[model samples]
Target: MAVDQGTFRRAVARFATGVCVVTSLEGRADHAMTVNSFTSVSLEPLLVLFCVEKEARFYDAVIDSGVWGVSILNPDQRPAASWLSNRGRPLVGQLDRIPHHRGPETGVALLDGAVATMECRTTAVHEAGDHDIVIGEVVGAAVPASGPADEAGALLWHRGAYSRI
Candidate 1:
């Protein structure tokens, strides 16, 4: 039998995850949303992937722009994560209230205090259940000026809460 959604979610939460904000440009506006389902797929060509809910505004933006930025959050960037994750926040206003910089390669906005950032170009898209898995080729990457090279202290998601390890 299929597990209930809540049970599945809770079970999945047992696996600790790093939190990030995936950013992309939609027309002339910037779009971003908190995401934890990001993974590095390969190193040879430098591939990465993030999953976005089918209905999320960021999903469409990623598809339209064919590029996006991944901002790996630091422990101190919880407010940035909360703002991007909040569903009620207007999409167009997401970036206006935050201090961020546009990536040189993709022009996608990356949160200012992110521990690390990667600009990517979409290489493939696969639909799965209620979300879309977007795979990208990393075009550029760097750590924040104030961020440490060791990421053991990075912000993480576990049991529906944010934490640092």
Candidate 2:
């Protein structure tokens, strides 16, 4: 059975995921992109995964780069996530405006006040659909500034919005 693209997209949008800004260094320049395709793959060795469009400018940055950071957005960070996700808008200039910290593992920018931080090393990249699923071995991790003990936050998407349970 073939699923219509629009229907499949809308269906997936209904299944909201945690929002995050995946970042890496492009020399002295930094690259950031909003992503909701993140998930924890394992606990023993500490692993995580996120999908990136094969055509994204930062796709290679994530793949070829040795390290990266995933800054899990707080509920209030939806706006920042939306902006970073926008391909129509340039991201380089806005990065300087936001206060950022570099992870000890990756030297990638971790969004200030993010709900959580996960630093990872690229482990594997598998081709899937129009995206590539990149898995990372967790190197360094942290709780967001003032984050709750249970660690609650909002979920975001390209279409609709939803609150975390």
Tens-digit lDDT track for model 2 on 55-121? Answer: 9987977777767899887676767787788786775675776668998877889888787788999
Give the range of the ten consecutive residues with the poorest summed lDDT in model 1. Answer: 144-153
**Position 18, candidate 2: lDDT:** 75
User: TM-score for all predictions?
Assistant: 0.93, 0.88
lDDT of each model, Cα atoms only? Answer: 0.89, 0.80
Which candidate number maximizes lDDT? Answer: 1
Per-residue C-alpha lDDT of model 1 across residues 26-111, encoded as one tens digit per residue? 78998889999999999989999999999986777889999899999888888989988998798667788778998998888988
Model 2 misplaced regions, further than 4 Å: 145-152, 162-165
Give residue 13's lDDT in candidate 2 (0 to 100). 79
- Could you say which candidate leads in TM-score? 1
Error of 1 at 17 (Å): 0.2
Name every residue pair that clashes in candidate 1.
none
